[model samples]
Target: MNTMTVTKSVVMITEEASFRIKEMMEHNEEQDAFLRISVNGGGCSGLSYGMTFDQNSQENDVLDEQFGIAIIVDKEDAAILEGTKVDYKQSLMGGGFTIDNPNAIASCGCGTSFKAAARPAEEQPCE
Candidate 1:
């Protein structure tokens, strides 16, 4: 595996996030699957994040290992995701995953969408 340490990771995953993801994977019976993070077009803020457990990786994927969990990010999305942090937070309302991307210049109120600093031209209004 071409896994990298957290210090050199393109996207940092916090311990809390790792624990939550591991729990989900175990519950879903996908213990050996890799956590794949991707950027996709079409959101209130021009881009959105996707997370899934992938059993296979593509040729251009970047692999990282943090907290004993395998993480994969597509090469094309690396530039926009660089320095991004994934964290899990708990509150009276409940718990959820949060993403903080250094490249994001704007984000919608929904929080799942963001506009990358270099992709301002791609921004679209919410429908």
Candidate 2:
């Protein structure tokens, strides 16, 4: 047996979110797809997290897999998303992917956008 140990990364996916994503993908029946987690300008906070499916990924996109799901984040956004957990909660109010980011210095109460430790201007670098 090979002695090299695999170093697993820590991208968090809450149980509810996993179930929801799986159901959505299976229901949609689109094989050429992935969950795109990203950050873009505009929100109650200085910046905001963007989640979508089946757009396009730049060549530099960082690919990750966790909990039987594929994740795609831009090379730059990877820094901001590190150590972050994506979760979904069906609270009576609503439900969505919650970012549990250790890097966030401040986050909006709506749980959408956040300011990183460096607080870079709302300018998302051009691809």
After superposition, the stretches of candidate 2 with alpha carbons farther than 4 Å from their true spots are 1-10, 122-127
RMSD of each: 2.7, 6.2
The lDDT, on a scale of 0 to 1, for candidate 1 is 0.86
Best by lDDT: 1
Residue-level lDDT of model 2, residues 1-127, one tens digit each, is: 1122223444567778889888877888844576778778766667787777754556667776666766777768777878888888788897766678898888767666668865574633322
lDDT of each: 0.86, 0.69
Worst 10-residue lDDT window, candidate 1: 1-10
Reference-based TM-score, model 1: 0.88
**TM-score versus the correct structure, for each prediction:** 0.88, 0.75
- Model 2 residue 15 CA deviation in Å: 3.1
